[model samples]
Target: MDKIKIDIMYLFGASGHGKVIAEIAETCGIVIDGFIDCDDNKKSVLGYPVFKELPSTTESLVVAIGDNGIRKKIVDNNIDAKYPIIIHKMSTVSKRTLLGAGTVIMAGATINVDVNIGQQCIINTNASVDHDCLIEDYVHLSPNVALAGNVTIGEGTHVGIGVCIIQGIRIGKWCTIGAGAVIIRDIPDGCTVVGNPGKIIRKMND
Candidate 1:
């Protein structure tokens, strides 16, 4: 039998998160060329070589790091490389939804109609974003998160696992919503909110 050849894309980061993203790519039947990481000592990830520099031959890249700031920074630096939007085969995304480049919609996630998800975002396993929600760039929606209709999550925010945001809530940029918290009102930028009816536990220093 003739060898089946597949075009492979490059992945950035070689940590645990990178391994997860590579698995997702595999689930989608996409082949990964290898990892392009800054760490010289890191040799391989999931059997694929970790290259200090991305090969010129590969045209596409995926920023797999979980940190919002780092993900944004990497994408900003590699704007010339093609960033493919990756959606798990099991995830249900509406036809009307607009997903930006390098976003990963993980398995069992459900994105309702007219949702706008920005670049390099992570919609993790079993998360649900309801109708008309706006998820900005580099946002991380952790596993099992539920966002009600019309919720607007700002850029670079991290919504923790099992959190629920009520309808019409606006979470500001660079904020952190702690695990299992229920967001009932607007959260200001750079604040960390936690507990039921989420309250600002602390505001991040600029």
Candidate 2:
């Protein structure tokens, strides 16, 4: 992706996930201007002022929300906003890896060679994405989740914390892989998977 020259950076969402994104920006030596939150009750985050609207000046923004659907919604609503790729200083990303705009790679995360991660996705703290993995838009690889080589995670899927997927497995769109589940085979779209060797427990409504 092309480099985004940000004069100032602001994070959208002022909660726990937003705090972590703020630290990632600070670790990267980027100063956060403030946080933009919809909640009027949130006066500030991490000592930075919280505003209800985006500043008029040219600035980059990162959607700091954790939910895949909501992140996608925010990105869609702000189509003209500049969304930069935010990678934590401690994360290891390959030179050949292709990360889309607004994707955040958190501290201790490792994205191996030939990985293609789409926009507004979150490779959360300590997540491991092995080589040749294709993670679609708005997906969330939660902390400590592991993916074997050649894994393809479809759009809007949330791979829960500590979940493990074997090589060459294709997880379908909008699926929810529950925490600590072990995926051994392909998962269908809109399914909610759980347990070891992950079994589809239910299908989510469209």
Candidate 3:
């Protein structure tokens, strides 16, 4: 069977994680256009050209950067959204797993065997997402954010860098977790949580 070909551009990352993004693209039978990186010393990675400027193309792009803030910054650029790309291959998704377009799964970010991750989610560097998890659209699992088995996450939620969610906990939509927060309970919708054990410090203005 012949696979459909798609062109994907990766931005805001280089080195090992970027290579993983490329690897997933290759595994999915997609072609990588190149990379856009902020690193000055890296002109290219694994033979793919790196640029300071994002090229004017409608082809979909995956933000492979590890930092949550940088990833958000890179995504702020306005671009045509007609062609959405998916970078997946090494992902251990079950047949039931549902992933939307323009998502980037970094190396060692596990989606479990039957997890459902939504569109444009950033399964960031070294994050461990366990089995049967349900992650909604635009969620950012920051670097090292660990979700135990069966966790249910709301849409557009930002799990902070190194935040740990216990098994089966439900995190509300558009919630923000501070760096290193440990989530042991359900968080209400539209809130910001922080500290060793996460607590809602302020409600979201929206």
RMSD of each: 2.3, 2.9, 4.3
Tens-place lDDT digits, model 2, residues 1-206: 23334777789899999999988887777777899898989998889999998888636889999999888888888788889999987999999999999999999999999999998899999999999999999999999999999999999999999999999999999999999999998999999999997999998673
**What are the lDDT scores of the predictions, listed in order?**
0.91, 0.92, 0.74
Task: Give one digit per residue, the lDDT tens place, for model 3 in 1-206.
Answer: 24555554554467676677777766776666787777788898878888876776636677765444455456666445432545455444456667776677765666667888876687877788888999987788888888999999998788888999999899988888999999999998889999878888999784
Residue clash pairs of candidate 2:
none
Quote each prediction's TM-score. Answer: 0.93, 0.94, 0.68
Give per-residue lDDT, candidate 1, residue 42: 92
Cα deviation in Å at residue 148, candidate 3? Answer: 2.5
TM-score of 3: 0.68
* Backbone clashes, candidate 3: 0
Task: Point out the higher-scoring one by lDDT: 1 or 3.
Answer: 1
* Model 3: worst 10 consecutive residues (lDDT sum): 78-87
RMSD versus native structure for model 2: 2.9
Please report the candidate that would top lDDT against the real structure: 2
| lDDT for residue 73 in candidate 3, whole number 0-100 | 56
